[model samples]
Target chain A: QGGVAIAECAACHGEDGIGKDVEIPNLAGQHEVYLYRQLQHFKSGKRSHKEMRFESRQLSDADMQALAHYYSQLPR
Target chain B: QGGVAIAECAACHGEDGIGKDVEIPNLAGQHEVYLYRQLQHFKSGKRSHKEMRFESRQLSDADMQALAHYYSQLPR
Candidate 1:
């Protein structure tokens, strides 16, 4: 499930979960709960990132959870 | 200047920039631009965290930059 969503994320976040740009956060080795919360914040407009908001809007709670887990386990 | 503001952050983030809780982020070695942007988001209410919003509101742009630089240099 996360692998599917990660396809989109790879554009900026990279396949290794390391962000392609300095302004983008590196998701590798991040706390799962923290990542999930940020995704929730983006979805709810509580964290404002134009692209992140749009991307997170496409995810369900489970998708977000899976994505967070997937990325959190990646090597930093 | 950043050292002064960091005293408050040390309570939760620790002197090493490691978060005390899973919900909080580990700031050590994070991208400076990313950290700065997050602080700006908190100050502007673009990223909504009750405590963070209040803390960031007290910081000037230069203060945020200093704090970002200070934390980003810490060992991960």
Candidate 2:
């Protein structure tokens, strides 16, 4: 992910994208396109969750793409 | 899973739990606990996506459990 730090994601999604909480999704090995799209939705307000929207809104397209690539590559 | 009529779910999430849109997550074979928790979150406003919130709010706890079980059993 181009060396960007995404520590915030680890709080809920865990360090490996296997989400820490049962309510959260395990992002590991999910489709990269799907990851990117969901981030876009959260950023655009098409999808709205308090924490996710806040986090995603701060992401640039590059950040979103990088995170998507990062998570999609992880083992579930 | 017990013939509770969840036709509304088939719109974004297809008949087989494979989401029709690239942005949506495929729910097939996802964790039952995870699915159930998310449905609860959507139902309770802990998470919010317009359509999801609207639909989930209409579901009873039994409906959430049934839907979760149904999706978790499908092939991803």
* Tens digits of lDDT, candidate 1, A1-76: 7777999988998888878899987788778899999899889987778999999999999999999998888876
Tens-digit per-residue lDDT, A1-76, candidate 2:
5244378887788777777766787777677898998888788876677898999977889999999989878764
Instruction: Please give the DockQ score of every candidate, comma-separated.
Output: 0.72, 0.37
The parts of candidate 1 lying over 4 Å away from their true place are none
Model 2 over residues B1-76: C-alpha lDDT tens digits? 4354467797788768877876677787677898998888788876676888898888888889998989878865
Native contacts, share recovered per candidate? 0.74, 0.42
The docking category that best describes candidate 2 is acceptable
lDDT of 1 by residue, B1-76 (tens): 7777999888888888878899988787778899999899889987778999999999999999999999889876
Error of 2 at A60 (Å): 4.7
Poorest stretch of ten by lDDT in candidate 1 chain A: A24-33
Clashing pairs in 2: none
TM-score, chain A, candidate 1: 0.95
